[model samples]
Target: MKSNIKYKKTKLSTTTKIALYKTMLKPRLIEEKMLILLRQGKISKWFSGIGQEAISVGVTMAMQAEEYILPMHRNLGVFTTREIPLYRLFSQWQGKANGFTKGRDRSFHFGTQEFNIVGMISHLGPQFGVADGIALASKLKNKNQVTAVFTGEGGTSEGDIHEALNVASVWQLPVLFCIENNGYGLSTPTKEQYNCENLADRALGYGMESHIIDGNNILEVYTKISEITESIRKKPRPVLIEFKTFRMRGHEEASGTKYVPQDLMDQWAEKDPIENYRLHLLTEGVLTEKEDAIFKAEIKAEIDTHLDKTNAEEVIVSTESNELNDVYKDFEYQNIEESSNTNELRLIDAIHEGLKQSMEKHDDLVIMGQDIAEYGGVFKITDGFVEAFGKDRVRNTPICESAIIETAMGLSIAGIKSIVELQFSDFVTSGFNPVVNYLAKSHYRWNQNADVVLRMPCGAGVAAGPFHSQTNEAWFTKTPGLKVVYPAFPKDAKGLLATAINDPNPVLFFEHKALYRSIRQEVPTDYFTIPFGKAATLKQGTDITIIAYGQAVHWALNTLEKHKDISADVIDLRSLQPLDTETIYASTKKTGRVIILQEDSLFGGIASDISALIMENCFESLDAPVKRVASLETPIPFINHLEDQYLARDKFEDELLALLAY
Candidate 1:
């Protein structure tokens, strides 16, 4: 697991050596102070990087300040080396308002955009893909910026690591995959984590050069990372560098090192990075004992001063009204001028046109998905996108949903608008973590805009079977930070999609595959935007109210047209997350009878939420109980008859009649 190839000593100037030493020493002292605070019950938790400061300081010092770094929780030295204000970082630890995440998140689980550092989510692997996106943006902008992302050896086993490596290699992005092989991932040792002798050996599988460095040696780590980053900046390719090190502390303060053998711990103790580096500095006469003592005293004093200030600051206090603030950015509806010219387009074509128009308007816009470039996607929504926008803008990704979703999030972070088309909405589950955890929560957590649109081709009726057919809007609607748009008509699809793309928050734009070619309408040729949280009433009637979205909207309209006796208000809720409550309540109170329809299974769909809302707000105006007509509670069937029997359409008319008669 050790590198046999010796590295020639790279001479450092006296000032640079002192700076590096100070950077490494600052985190050690700060963490020591934090541990004291944690033990004193002042702070909630701490993940100590007690003996692993070399990797964080060395790699951060080697990379340019303009380059991005996605640091793990243990990379406290990265923040210190980047010169982020110690007071702010202390406030973050204490969950104060001035922290990077504004007390929305605690500890190092927050990112500071001004410092060009992205903090990792609880799930460790997604930051790799986000780093790739930052590198991709650098390449597109010709900035020659290299992105460095850190992880442990155990994180190498994540699918995201593999996907990001392959993607960076294929795209020839300038990235440094910094793996601090810190002996163990929590209690799991490297012997049980992987079969490979060294984590760097896996780099060959990714078609990228690899390096193994003595992480305990600060000089070697700095030299190796500097050389690797320089080479990558010039050649623009990802390289894996495994910094062989050990975690001297538990994974977190609560976790103890009961599983680690005493002999191994004792062996690593002698190779303590800071102690060994200090000895090296003294022996070389670069730092005297008096100077080292002065540095330590200065760092300790600075940390104590900032700790007092951070503790004195008011802790985050949340109220019901203010708690909901910034879950989504305030959106102002723009009235776009439309030309008289119109085209009769299918739902898919309208979406295509909307994307083309958006891409034409926004130079930073890029579309990414599997087979979306030349294959035009499974539903052909992005058919000619590659030809219209170039391969760079129209990207085809490997079958790595989580990576691509988080990659799009990265692109958004770097001021690029991205549209990720999930081949099928059902596949969103594969990318669910990033969509819900990272992208959806980015804005609310750190005030970072994830200007990405996920085009989900959803719904059943085409008999594509269980995997491809699903109406999973209910999955994301409950997630607060995302905007969900499911348009029922071509005009609505085009307009709503345009609006979603322009929105600052992450938006899930669901397109029903069954309605792709079936629905047609006179959509405007010119660009326009339909405001979110607004429902479109297809038909206005006084007897009963029918609320639906996607294909079910068409079913409601068709059933109303077929039965002339049925007088109903057909409400198409184009946007699900920002439910059109005003329109729904008005219709419900007008008719006093309501039926909510959904193509998803009946048990836990959006219909259930809408029914509950009606009861809670419009209870006094109700004539009868709200009816929820939805698909049968089972996976979508492939057979024609079974599929029809499972869909809500088969029972929609009967349900409508019952609600009307109520």
Candidate 2:
């Protein structure tokens, strides 16, 4: 199955032409229905899959049911053909109840394993990672299912796409990557998008089998996709297919495409994929005008009925409310005797115990970081796990932060919930590219969770010095997709870590080394997982309030002893992402005076965010202006003495002075 723009130069049977024509007409009718729905004020927002239907319909229809389809935003054609009820599409477009994924999902962003559509991610090629993952899962399960991921020319630029490709090719994973080149990326033409004329050729770097095809021609597309998908399934290798076509419609419904050249639109519109395929079928003597008209009308009525059913649905439900339910199956937990009734299990011990338990329960749980395995991690948090779990489960990697995230992402794509450590929160800057561009936004961009866990020790107290310690939760506090957690107590350390491991979203677990072993408290040896967004209160008072997290929780606790008569309340923020302002407000409303303490530098830290939260939520409850105690904004000195002097060594004492003076 191969093709060239000049001509396919291959013979096709009349029956084959009829099947291709029918497949092409079905998607065209669907597109027409969606367009009509848009003008009727029923459909609001959507990215229409207008011109690339030939490839989408042909490849997906030719794919075996056991194999998987990981499509992109432009793959509604493929999904519609897979029997995803048109009502499901209409419900999703209108955010109505019949949508199946529930109203929580967006258009062209739904998937179902029952339909053999393993995953559909809209943020371009994030499906590459997911596609690789399903393939990995298939191999691990010894199943014969192959994974096919589709992306556009622009997606080839993302690191995640290449990363997935590299790993898939290296492992000879049963996967196919289809690149639909529509000649433009939001008006940025292919020349500006990449140096290569044909993006599939770039797959050579990863030893991937590559092909170039005429995407608008249904016959050519069907043969190529069938051939490539079959070859990968037989030999278990990765392949790349570049479909050359033009995007006749704008990037999306709301997109004006003002930047698209009128000349290109005129030329490409003349070669509309549906029309091209119709002519191809006719030239091959497949269907008469009467039969073609009847086929078009029949599909149009079917889509019209689907639209009626979808619009009649309530605006509340999704295609499947059970999406998050039982995504993991038969999880394995550590088989160990319960701890004896004893006070010896500290918070750090509890965290270790929890991770040990989780890894024992789920084979998909993986751990990796610098010195994590060989050295049991820089802080010894993961000590002795390498011997117990084996290197494949508890592994170590090189010092490259980008590579660490990339590999962990691949591991996540491989169906493992990887707990990747960055050693320190301050050093996360090295991996910021992947974290911000990929990990943090992967779920939001892909319209599905990636579930990669990033673990790092944070905070500046305990005199570890600047390079070794820092707290920068606010750096990503506002990022929408990533969950950041900075637990303050031993109990939270254990419970939060446990909860984080089970969450479907990527969690930035900032473990303060200063408190990892220093803070000791009773923790349940049992699986008493604490919720991720809740806050904890350590003490209650009336005159003033002190807010803190991580090492600052210790300082707040110690200050409580001296300020007992001052009527001060303290708050320990267990999770930074969903900051428990309700708890913070309850305490501040009682104390009236608010003060935030943080171990990070004064320039920009969680304290600033806390102050803003307090001012916004508890402004009128204040008897005085809110105050903060933070380390000075400077590099941490290597000397212990200099480091001590550099941070808020006597911050509590100074805070007390200011409170009493006020």
Candidate 3:
């Protein structure tokens, strides 16, 4: 490691120096106590930060109290330095109800907004983008707050880290990207991870300043970080700092360090952060042998007292308690009366109007996606949005799907409402982790509000091939804490989108590409919001029931119009997650037969779930088995003839006739 010790010129007060020493020593002592508990089989796992006290304590102490820090699994010093209660921290490890996550999550996989600490998920890279978002919120609100996000040498390889770095640099966000190069990512060493000599060197490619620090030297780590953060707060720009350190313990207690060479361990052992800092303080006359012994003893006693209190706390036992009730916040839809004045508009125009009105209503609302600023996006839905809302609100992003989605989560964390438009619905797969894992589970895990609207332009009939067109509502509907909205007509599109933007939970809003200009209706000119989980009965009948959403709703309506003789109930399900089962069951019982339609493939689609729901609830009322009319089980073909054959539209009439005859 390079010796970048530039701490000679920086003078620290005696009081500050002693405080730093005490803060750094606390987690190391806590780790030792936790190891004893692990051996006693009282705790399940532990990620020891035995050798990494300097980076966590130094960086966190350097940051302002109002600023946020996103810490990794091993940075227990961050929690301690931030003055988090020891009893609560121990309770989290013990899975007690008093923990940060209320025992919904384990270890440091939870965040406490009260302490301005955002904890990392198991997938470490997403937090970088989330940090950028929090910084973006600060920038927008004109606050001099810098967000510090940490990752390891192994985590730098993730695409999200690179994307977040580029975004921070491009947007001039105030973010401190800290990398702890601790030699190994699990069992893989730095040599096998990346060919770059130093992870800080990668910052040059992002046009950001980079620095290397001797992470074992507490004074050096503190001085450099304090200087860097002061510069960031003044000018509001991101900087990358690579802290060259070593993990003295196994990645976890269960994962032994047998793979690490013996000589390498001995070399790192000689430079233990806490031991070196204590000796340096003693040599500088800031600490004496008696004082050091007293401090160590006091810390051990504090840990024991907290551990005893934590042991007395009750462990979470009820699986069916408040855990189920906390998955999503109750969203009561406001009934905004529609105006008598109306305009004949296409589905796309209705969505645009709704978004424009929403921006007018909420000053903190921001919409981000690729080509959304100047180009108006691929479909021109946001053509005039940038000019109206300004660049800050109507932002354009790179082709980093994961980063943008995770960034939206950060914005929500900072009390800003956001909308993320995926250029195509098919690209959702690239950003699935933040959407499904982080965003969906955040509220249930820690009561974090994710007020984000993910607008996905989906469905086929435009022949854009498989990559550009898809009906993937079923993907998000299966994930709890997400609302799925797929409106069929112009009025429904406008109203449902308005509702989605105002919702407190994450919402997946699917706009059908084929219905953009094809479907037109006289929509209310005034702002209005349609309630979710309420199916609109377009046509009322008693003979049969046709349940559908998105483009399939149009297919059902067209089929019913063509066959006037067949009386059927055509239900347009505007929202899928909070499904209107009352309307569905009423129609199913009124008519003994049902046809569920969807543009997605037949196998494992939303149509299958609805079919099963009807069978289980209204089994005796069924004249024939609940029928599902879906696309063929294959990738949507590019050729017009093959595409037509792959769609469910062609088979709708035949399936309707067969079901009617039953």
Candidate 4:
């Protein structure tokens, strides 16, 4: 239904109208050809944006070129509006060697920093969170830039969307949240999605300005967006603009229209943005019919030419040499190869030192977490950072875990290295999608290095219980393209964090909460880095090998001290991703016995992997079967007695003696 306000004539000049017509027509024709390609099996899939061209064109024209746009698969018009090279678009669709992702990704799952467009996956919610990061980065830099995020009405139901909106609102970031309410999300109609009569009204809850526009009306879309864009540039506040439009086609070329009514489709077709805008231009004397026809023909010819050229380009064949060519950036330790100074520091202070030192080294470093600013984190790991680095670098984010990690990913994409802190390690599950799907695979898929360090204060013994205490290193260790580092000592904590921040891949730095105050060491004043995949042999022995990490290392050390007669060599597997299996095997072969220890649950923990590695490599050298000691497979109890009983140190010691005797 049209708005009650009287329809006003567009004040756009003839040249502007002509330009809009040409811009809007480009994506419509491109998408039409894409569907044809899909039918011919030349392209794998087709997500048509047939009726949403005006929104894409209008928003693109309203925002500056430097402002980033995170477009979904259906927003093909965004690429066209941003003037991404026609051949590059066709090449990406054809999955050619010169594509944005070098043919590693097909469809709309690609982005380039050069064009300020973010790569989008099928999941729409997280992209908004990532876009919030881009906007936050721009605001922090004091740049008059804004980021535009495009999502469908159905995506607004996702928790990540709400989280992004809340974060954007609370921070007063400059973000344009453009929701294309295109009637249906895949197949579910708007009736099943939201209870609100107008989606824009939801913005009022966040205390942000809201507007609803007839997306098919190109002139109206352009004028409203231009006004909002100007206002956002000045105030840097998020604005939610729900463009009311409809999808005239099925969800994709493969999907049929059985879910949508023929009448509804017909109604939307009559309100086609391309055709309506062309008629408006004609009526406004922007172009003659002959001129309009020639312009469309020219666009069709251009698309066809690019399509043929992209089709002719060589397809990328996955080769042995290039298989892992760009999975990780090669980094070598340059300075401070060995420890030289003797300055005692608590684990917490060491961590703070590492962050301070890293920030001193890199100007683009940003630390974001809950209560990390003036409050200095729940554990005070980032205390005094806000004062030292300023609020712009040491940001206190809202308690949105998904947005936290996703924002770090976005900031990394925009060339800002980020250190994200999950107040407690247990909360990593809340942000699992971005960490596993986006952060972990970004380097492997697009050769983009997400330079993010996720500081997780993990482990038990402090009686913080299951909700607060968790050793989630195993989850990330199993995930490819992520570096998992768990340091057991203050020295290792400081060194590993410095190394993690420098590493090109995303690193999950697990800091034991119990060890924060319990462990004190004379850490090096000068910076030093311990290479990943290299295990440190803390003590030498001939009886057996005790391989452990995190708090388990301390437990094993105490076990050895209690039974001095049974000499044991302890190996610390600092980095879980590039595990030092060689060190583990050598120690196991020498001692002829292995005991793997971890603070995580026994069912599926890092200890299980360690035991498997010992058996696989040092099976013949073993004098007895490998023993594993881990927390019981149950949620940590809130009571200290139950938690202590769950982690029986005596039982672990008894198992160690049995292995030694065997």
Candidate 1 collision pairs: none
Write the candidate numbers in order of decreasing TM-score: 3, 1, 4, 2
| Each prediction's whole-model lDDT (CA) | 0.89, 0.72, 0.91, 0.85
Displacement of residue 182 (Cα, Å) in model 2 is 1.9
Residue range 360-475, candidate 1, lDDT tens digits: 99987989999999998877778888888899999999898998888898888788989998999999999889999998888888888798999999988888899988899989
Worst 10-residue lDDT window for candidate 1 reads 1-10
Q: After superposition, how far is residue 407 of candidate 4 from its true place, in Å?
A: 1.6
Tens-digit lDDT track for model 2 on 1-662?
Answer: 11122336556667766777787677777777777777777776656678888888888877886677878777776776687777666776777766545555577666664576644444555567667656766665676667777888988897667767776776577877888999888778899999975788798787778889888877778887777777666678888889888887778767767778899888777667777666655565566778889998888888878777865665573234244332222223322333444344555676677788778877768787778886887767789998899876776665556645655654565456878888887788877766666665544333335567788777665676666777777778777667788887766776677778887677888877767667777665665467766787777777777788877777777866775666667778889886888888888888788888877777677777788888898889888888878887787776777777776747667776687578
TM-score of each candidate structure, all chains considered together? 0.98, 0.79, 0.98, 0.95
Task: lDDT for model 4, please.
Answer: 0.85
Per-residue CA lDDT of model 3 for 154-251, tens digit only, reads 99999899999999999999999999999999889999999989999988899999999988888888888999999888899999999999999899
Better of 2 and 4 by TM-score: 4
Residue 280 of model 3, lDDT score: 73
Which is better, 1 or 2, measured by TM-score? 1
Of models 2 and 3, which has the larger TM-score?
Answer: 3
Report the Cα lDDT for candidate 1: 0.89
RMSD per candidate (Å) reads: 2.2, 5.6, 1.8, 2.4
Best by TM-score: 3
Model 1: CA > 4 A from native: 1-8
